[model samples]
Structures are given as C-alpha cells and as structure tokens.
Target: MIKWILILLVVAAVASLLGYHTLAGAAATGARILIGIVLVIFLLVLFGLFAVT
Candidate 1:
C-alpha cells in the first residue's frame, strides 16, 4: 500500500512535469487518499500495541 502510494506520487510528479494536469491531479489524489488510510491504520495499530502492553 505504501509502495503503491509512492509509485502514484512519482507518477504524479512525472505527469506534472510533462504537463498532463489531469493525470497528475488524479495520481496526486490517489496518493493522498492512500497515505491517509495508511496513517490511520498505523495509528490504530500503535494504539492497540500500547494498550495491550
């Protein structure tokens, strides 16, 4: 999931550099959404680990 996000981010950067505004925006949005989901899951896991300890 994180790898996908990174890939999408790179795609976004390259698209932006090539002036593909629509593709860049879509890829950027995908990366942002994936990052948010990963962050939320990470926080939940961290809290669960602390709670168990």
Candidate 2:
C-alpha cells in the first residue's frame, strides 16, 4: 500500500510539472487540480495505513 502511494505521488508530481509547464489554459489548470487531489488522497491513505499498523 505504501509502495502504491509512492508511485501515485511520483505520477502526480510529474503530472503537476507537465501541467504547469504547459500553456496556461483551462485544461492545464484542470489537470493540475485533479492530480493534486489524487496526490492528497494517496498521501492520506498512506498515513492511514501507517497508523493502523
């Protein structure tokens, strides 16, 4: 689970960077926001797993 979270984080980071580098448009901003949300959710899950263990 932790590993999955790490993978997700990396993907999110890459997506965020790409979105930021892309032209400032609605699509880019939308993508960035979506990735940010996904990253946060994954981080929360990782923390939950740690706490349970």
Candidate 3:
C-alpha cells in the first residue's frame, strides 16, 4: 500500500512534468486517498481497536 502510494506520487510528478494535467491530478488524488486510508488503519492499530497476530 505504501509502495502504491509512492508509485502514484511518482506517476503524478512525471505526468505533471509532461503537461498531462488530468493524469497528474488523478494520480495525486489516488495517493492522497491511500495515505488517508493508511493513516486511519495505523491509528486504529495504535489504539488497539484493531488486532494483529
């Protein structure tokens, strides 16, 4: 998941450099959403609301 976020960010950067504004925006949005999801999951685990074996 973290890897995906990184990949998306790279893609966004490249797209922006190439002047593909729409693609860049989409990739950036995807990265932002994944970051939010990861943050929420991390918080849940930290507070013991989620269990891991």
Candidate 4:
C-alpha cells in the first residue's frame, strides 16, 4: 500500500510537470484515498480496536 501511494505520487508529479492536469488530479486523489485508509488502519491498531493476529 505504501508502495502504491509512492507510485501514485510520482505519477501525479510527472503528470503535472507534463501538463496533464486531469491525470495528475486523478493520481493525486488516489494517493490521498490510500493515505486516508492507511491512517485509519493505523489509528485502529493504535487504539487496540484492530488485531494484527
């Protein structure tokens, strides 16, 4: 997931640099969603609401 986020971010940056605004926006949005999901999972585990086992 982290790898995916990094990939998306790189894509967004390259797209933006190349003036592909639409593609950049989409990639950025995807990265944001993945980050949110990761954050939520981290919080749940921190609070002991999620079990790793």
Off by over 4 Å in 3: 49-53
lDDT by residue (1-53, candidate 4, tens digit) is 99999999999999999999999999999999999999999998887854654
- Pairing residues by index, what is the TM-score of model 4? 0.90
Clashing pairs in 3: none
Stretches off by above 4 angstroms in model 4 are: 49-53
Mark the regions of model 2 whose C-alpha exceeds 4 Å error after superposition: 1-24
Residue 35 accuracy (lDDT) in model 3: 100
Q: Per-residue alpha-carbon lDDT of model 3 for 1-53, expressed as tens digits?
A: 99999999999999999999999999999999999999999998887854554
lDDT per model, in order?
0.98, 0.63, 0.96, 0.96
Listed per candidate, the RMSD to the true structure in angstroms reads: 0.5, 7.7, 3.0, 3.0
lDDT of 2 at 5: 48
Worst 10 residues of 3 by lDDT: 44-53
On TM-score, the leading prediction is: 1
lDDT of 1 by residue, 1-53 (tens): 98999999999999999999999999999999999999999999999999999
RMSD of 3: 3.0
